[model samples]
Target: MYIGLGIVLIVLGAILAFALNIDIPGVGDDTLGYILMAAGVLAIILSFVATRRRPAGYTTTRESQVDPATGSRVDHTDIDPR
Candidate 1:
């Protein structure tokens, strides 16, 4: 979601900064557009960093098996270290 928002902001900023030409009393269109683009880039970087820091899902289980030669049952453990 955040990544998508970042992409949208970047596109809008580019359009505002480069494609359109307008004049405002106090605020400059190019300046605002650059700011938006910068903000979008920052959001994208933050999203990437946040996703990288997330912990992966994991599952663990135990299974029982019988040994043919010994005629004995053995238990085995399995773990996912994601």
Candidate 2:
């Protein structure tokens, strides 16, 4: 989702920067375009960083054990304990 958003932002920024020529009161088209492009780049980078896979040492496992106090079966789940 983030990657897609970044691509869209980049595309929109390119259009605003190069395709159209409009004069606004306080903001210039080029400035807005540059800002959008920068934001898009940041988003793309952040998405990649956030979605990276975990290290090999990380693992998830489930085990069944009997509870000594309760004297009943119980399910235990462990994730990346180390």
In angstroms, the error of model 2 at 36 is 0.4
Looking at model 2, report the run of 10 residues with the lowest lDDT sum: 50-59
Name the best candidate (by lDDT). Answer: 1
**How far in Å is the alpha carbon of 74 misplaced in model 2?**
20
**TM value for model 2:** 0.65
Per-residue lDDT value at 12 in model 2: 87
lDDT of 2 at 72: 100
Worst 10 residues of 1 by lDDT: 24-33
| Cα lDDT tens digits for candidate 2, 1-82 | 5888898889889988999998978999988988888889999999988877434466789999999998999999889843
For candidate 1, lDDT tens digit of each residue in 3-79?
88889889988988999988967988898889889889999999999989877997789999999999999999989
Return the TM-score for each candidate structure: 0.67, 0.65
* Total backbone collisions for each predicted model: 0, 0
Which candidate achieves the best TM-score against the true structure?
Answer: 1
Clashes of 2: 0
For model 1 the local lDDT of residue 21 reads 89
